[model samples]
Target: MSTPQDINVRQKPAVAATGGGTSTILATKQLTKNFGGLTAVDGVDFSVAEGEIRCLIGPNGAGKSTLLELITGQLAPSDGAIYFDGEDLTGLDTHKRIDTGISVKFQSPHVYENLTVEENLRVPLQRTDRDVDRVLAETLDRTALSEKAETGASELSHGEKQRLEIGMAVTLDPKLMLLDEPVAGMSVDETDDVADLIRSLHDDGMTFVVVEHDMEFVRRISERVTVLNQGEIFRQGPIEEIEADEDVRRIYLGENA
Candidate 1:
């Protein structure tokens, strides 16, 4: 199993003027995904810099999830290429991707409902050679779940369960974490809490690519935004720039926004 040390993750990198880092950690060229006659993701080129939090948003069926699936190797791309940390991830399986410091927290909480919080962390740790006790402690504290260490996941609040799921991914000390609708179905306060946690983790040098719908959460979590439409990149830049576009407001944000 590979670890963060194996890849030499460059932390605290100098971010570019437009919210991108000097180094490109992940990139896809002409990436496309199709299901027979329906092309969900058209030919697209995307990139993410190291130590950056990138948000992907669009109206329904804009291919946000499909693009994420391609990166995680959940679904193979019909065309184009995906490169990560200077390695080709085309044929690599999801487990291999995790070994290379790529972990994901899907849209829903995926905790072991029957298990305790500490036990849930242990499952992912089984893949790593790190000290179990130390990781469990750190993950609990970082996720603000220390008090619930012995609590069953099914008993935790919705937000706490989300945190636990995120902690499960962070236990491996991944380099990049892909989150899909991480703040879904949460109160404003809970959503804010998740955003703060992500920012705190980013401060610790973990990169993130988040697929979210809540614009407020997106503004709070990411400086750069990528808007996809019709399986293609409609626009990408500073959050304010994307938000201020008239076409974007008219099409996705609507007149009231």
Candidate 2:
């Protein structure tokens, strides 16, 4: 794990094309996680600048999800520290992290099938100082799900469910958002729509760290990317630089070109 001082010394200023604001919002120091004898995340260090849509790309079992879980407190790291908004969060619980404006959306939609779209959103709405009705209205409008707000979660198409999950994340007005494979199984059109939604959110000043396997989608949304392999960072740089690197291509992209 690297310290803030280490990041400042080694990491160049993140490029500005992706709308990353010039302030650091989240920082990690020598973050490590282990599950019994299995070391899932090994001393990873990174910083997410304010308003940047940073993407984490890696092969399966590369520890991307584990890193997210550690940051969100779904799992505690065996060592290292996490700092968000200038406060130490390495010791906080998941809900506590949420309360501090860190929200995570899993790959699978977690909405309640029994609940209406409006009701599904109400769960997170109940946690903030923001007015629930106002947040709900904004979320519905943003996701274009107003018409389906009264529809049950189970009634939604796969795309709609994905949008709803994003809407729920939006309603929280988080300082940092972790999206895990947000368009995992959507059609091409649906993938495009979700990509647009993510771009819009970034434009609206939201910071995001997305874990995705969709290279094209990642290229569309991320200005900078971090590659993780076998639990450690393999590369970190602007998208074009990463894409053109032979090592990155061999390890993650393969001959898919």
Candidate 3:
């Protein structure tokens, strides 16, 4: 595990592109989603680079989940286009999008409690062409569950369960990972452990698009922050700029601002 300083979690100048170089792994253009008379995700443009760790933060009802669902193909957008790895993904279904290197881990841990950590990993690995043993070992080491490989999912702590789900998501070797509230319900030490795991994975060339409300956790691992409000992008920049913005302070931070 590396310190925040050692991990390169500093603010950067504004840019139209993120990740590494000009490669955009995921992009949503004029993305919108509505439920009858109510709009959840209004027209919004969002993009993430190839190897960036981007955090999406906002208040409840800020359309964070809707936006994530739209991108993941769990819900269809009323209008808009989604592109991934330089191809259109707007009309693709959830499993199809996943087949193309887009994987999502929702807020809850969806592991098989009766299965061991390694067995849970095998569920997803069997779907891919990779060698099961090699990928399993790597995933265990990456998620810091190497010693707990044979432990049943039901026996693991809340944080360990979260890590197991993450490991399963990576079994297919996704190019872009959408993590919703990765640190939700985690203790201080657990959160720190997860953050360190995330950083370690990023260092290994993984791209992540995370939706998290925990500001301290966000500050721990984010290279950039995207602030969403009222179903749209209120602001997007480095964490420093976001923390300094008067409008963001007023709407999101409130008295703390």
Candidate 4:
């Protein structure tokens, strides 16, 4: 079996700002996804700047998840293009995209319930040639799970499991991380903890594209917000700016906005 020490990941260099002084790490042009007759994601143009946090929000069926799938290569786009690290990644496979420094953590905790926290970290780094013990220690520290390293994943609290999942993603040393509803079901304290973690990572030069519905959490961690409506981008700006728009307030935010 492969071991963590045996895995050595080769990361791509960070891309500088391009195309009209925009330093977008990931960009999509008229990106669309369809399932036969139903268009899940309409032609949408989106972009994420390097080392920035961007949140995607909308009412149900706004294509937030679908847009995420397209960017991560879980579902191929029916039209448009995907650019990552300044290269075209429109038709790349999931694994290939991952190789290009993209990692994703879905809404649910996707951990190996039977494995210990340390073992979970070991599994992903097994193919790389990095030091297994060292990486494991670092990952535990980074995710705030060092004390629980020996505990089984099934025994971890929901928030701890979420952090563990994030730890696993970071082992890949990705430049951009996609998080879908990361703080869902987390307590206020837990949400704060995750937000702190995300900010810390961003401070360390990581870029993130997050999809969340909790406006409180969005307000806590979001630098910019993108509102999706019926498979298209309705508006994108600072959280305060998005909150002030009457149409967005009436449509998605309701009385809350």
Candidate 5:
């Protein structure tokens, strides 16, 4: 199993950067996904610079989850291509993508309810040098769940479960992480805590593509934001820039401004 001590910090590749390093760590060229008569995701071109926190947001049924599934290989795209670390990832399976240093955390926490918090993180500890104990401790600490380490997954609150989900993802030491509505249903305090954890990971040079409906949280965590509407790319740019665009506000943000 991977342990924290086994993490080869020097061997990890640098993430693509907005101005320097690699142009983009993850990019989608006209990616599309459809379900028979329903086009869940239209041709969408998306990219995230290394070390950047890119947020994907839109109204309900805007295809945010479908786009994430496509990028993470949980679902194949009907058309276009996906590139990661300069390699085509179109046909790769989800496990293969995970092996390539990509991890994803769903909006609803997926914990083994019968297990302890420590055991929860052990599921992803199978292939890395990450110390199970260390990762467990750090993750619990990061999520303010240190006291809950021995608690059963079934005993955790909704927010604690969410934190544990994040802990599991980090144990993989992924180059990039995709989080879907991480703070959904979280209390204000829990939301702040989760945001702090995200910032901490970003500071460690981790790349992220986050989908969220919380505009306040999005503005706080994202360096860039991508807006989608009816499965199409509505707009993408710096958070402030996207927020200020009139068309984006109307079509995606639902703002009169």
Candidate 6:
């Protein structure tokens, strides 16, 4: 697949870049999430640059999902704040967050099992004031689901279902996509196809923060990697730095390490 423009993943000086300049699409300041006494996510500061693909990885119960939940407004943060495109999002509801151009494709392919692929894409597109017919056609081609337009979602393979669900989100033209375990059960070829889809979309200026466990897939698509451990960031840098760190390797070995 083709590569995107070279990205400088290093931290940038905050010069009030809103949709331009450094282009940090999303950021969290001392973000935290707690369930009673258990702190699932500590005061974590995370950010993703626009037109970049960032991979979030770590061992089980590493607060990956919690952090995503906080960003997506699935779970309210116990502390800290969330910023998207220079607007405060910590208080917005889930739908409001979506309205601000943040779309999420959770681990499950939550497509309408009974609906055809085209119908499924139409559901989200029709909800907005966008030109449904025009965007639907574009989403089909962008998601590689053009041939499956008339196919029932239940009749599709796992990979196709994944693409359909992703297309559902793409219909509304989201600025940043947070994907959770996008290739959990796919075959080798299917995983590669998803990687290529992401790369193509990234080249077109879509930003992504993908939470995945597949190391091979992560390395293939990620310009930057963040390793979370026990609700705190353990490592953050290029994939090569994350891979070469002995501490990060041991952390993945087990949570207790």
lDDT of each: 0.88, 0.87, 0.87, 0.88, 0.86, 0.87
Which pairs of residues collide in model 5? 2-128, 2-129, 2-130, 3-129, 3-130, 3-131, 4-130, 4-131, 16-50
Candidate 4 local lDDT, 156-219, one digit each (tens)? 9999999999999888888999999999999999999999999989999999999999999999
Clashes of 2: 2
Give me candidate 1's TM-score against the actual structure. 0.90
lDDT of 2 at 217: 94
List candidate 5 stretches off by more than 4 Å: 1-21
- Ranking 2 against 3 by lDDT, winner: 3
TM-score of 3: 0.90
Worst 10 residues of 3 by lDDT: 10-19
Name the top lDDT candidate: 1
How do the predictions measure up, each by TM-score? 0.90, 0.89, 0.90, 0.90, 0.89, 0.90
Q: Write candidate 1's Cα lDDT for 157-226 as tens digits.
A: 9999999999999999998999999999999998988999999999999999999999999999897999
Give the per-residue lDDT digits (tens) of candidate 3, residues 138-219: 9999898999999999999999999999999988888888899988999999999889988988887899999998999999
Give the per-residue lDDT of model 2 (tens digit) for 48-152: 888899999989999999999888998889998787875577777788889878889999998889999999999888877788888888899889899998999
| Reference-based lDDT, residue 105, model 4 | 97
TM-score (C-alpha) between model 2 and the true structure: 0.89
Tens-digit per-residue lDDT, 78-124, candidate 6: 99878788667777899998998988999989999999999999998
In angstroms, give how far residue 51 of model 4 lies from its true place. 0.6
**Model 5 poorest ten-residue lDDT run:** 10-19
As for candidate 6, its clashing pairs are: none
lDDT of 2: 0.87
Off by over 4 Å in 1: 1-22
TM-score: the better of candidates 2 and 6 = 6
lDDT of 4 at 144: 90
